[model samples]
Target: MHAIKIRLSQEELEQLENLAGAGYSLEQIAMYLDVPKNDFIAEFYDLDSFVNYHYKRGLLMVDAAAGLALAANAAGGNITAHQQLEKIRMAQFVEREKKRIIYGQETP
Candidate 1:
């Protein structure tokens, strides 16, 4: 995959850490990154790719959390209602993001 350079500051780094520590999924982080949801979905088809991509950028915590979320979404065991709920919420978030892009609310 071709990578475009995106910049982040110290404040964003701290925020990402907090979110990852709280078990936020890749989709959630992607949303926080403010890339249009549709673009994030197309580039990252699943959480695994997201983890690997982010890990290469030094997001250790987020990568590990993405791994857990991907695993839970893959296997049908040991998943709590909260994770399931977050998954659903992220799905809806992606859909809404698509809508925003379609409506031209998303900046390139």
Candidate 2:
């Protein structure tokens, strides 16, 4: 069956971002948006498209919020938060190094 493409309105775009930020899976997001899974996938199939861009931006938003909270807790002497924050930093560094090796030094 051919999937019908649906364009999201501004309000739906906002909902999509919020849902993604809340860690909803793609299938769940589709259901919440009242869209068929296949149609939703069809609309967002391009990773470089606006749909994916908003999705990733949403994920980054949550990551940033969590990191901020962790930093605050670590500053207040939470040992667990400190350790987790350090682990995240180390992982990010490792990922950057890997990217640099694979895609040259200019990778962001």
Candidate 3:
């Protein structure tokens, strides 16, 4: 048996993107769109892919704003801002190291 195909209109897609960016879960977005959660999942690639795309987009926006604030604070000699930036840099370095180790790359 062939699976039923569900097509989203352009407006619906835009709405989905907006809702997802607002941190709505897949189930919530599905309900807002008036589509069954299961059907929406089946129609789309998967919940993770759809949710992650929008969530990451939202995070990027937030990160940009935070970065601007941090820059201003650092320029004004805010020690806490400097510390927070260092912590974030260290965490990013650790994550990169982890990825390298997982991929069997020799670490210097």
Question: Once superposed on the true structure, which residue ranges of model 2 sit more than 4 Å away at CA?
Answer: 1-4, 103-105
RMSDs, each prediction? 12.1, 3.6, 5.2
TM-score of each predicted structure versus truth? 0.32, 0.77, 0.56
Candidate with best TM-score: 2
Better of 1 and 3 by lDDT: 3
User: What lDDT tens digits, residue by residue, belong to model 1 across residues 1-108?
Assistant: 535334445665566556656666657866887755555545444434443344345455655576667666657555664566567668768877887878756533
Q: Give a tens-digit lDDT track for model 3, residues 1-108.
A: 235455567677667777766777878888998988887766555434543454456556666678779978988999999888878778878977997889876655
Cα lDDT, all candidates: 0.58, 0.84, 0.70
Instruction: Compute the lDDT of residue 52 as modeled in candidate 2.
Output: 77
lDDT of 3 at 77: 100
Better of 1 and 2 by lDDT: 2
Worst 10 residues of 2 by lDDT: 1-10
Which parts of model 3 are misplaced by more than 4 Å? Answer: 1-23, 39-51, 103-108
| Residue 41 shift from truth in candidate 1, angstroms | 8.2
Highest-lDDT candidate:
2
The local lDDT score (0 to 100) that residue 29 gets in candidate 1 is 67
Which residue pairs in model 1 clash with each other? none
Give the C-alpha lDDT of model 3: 0.70
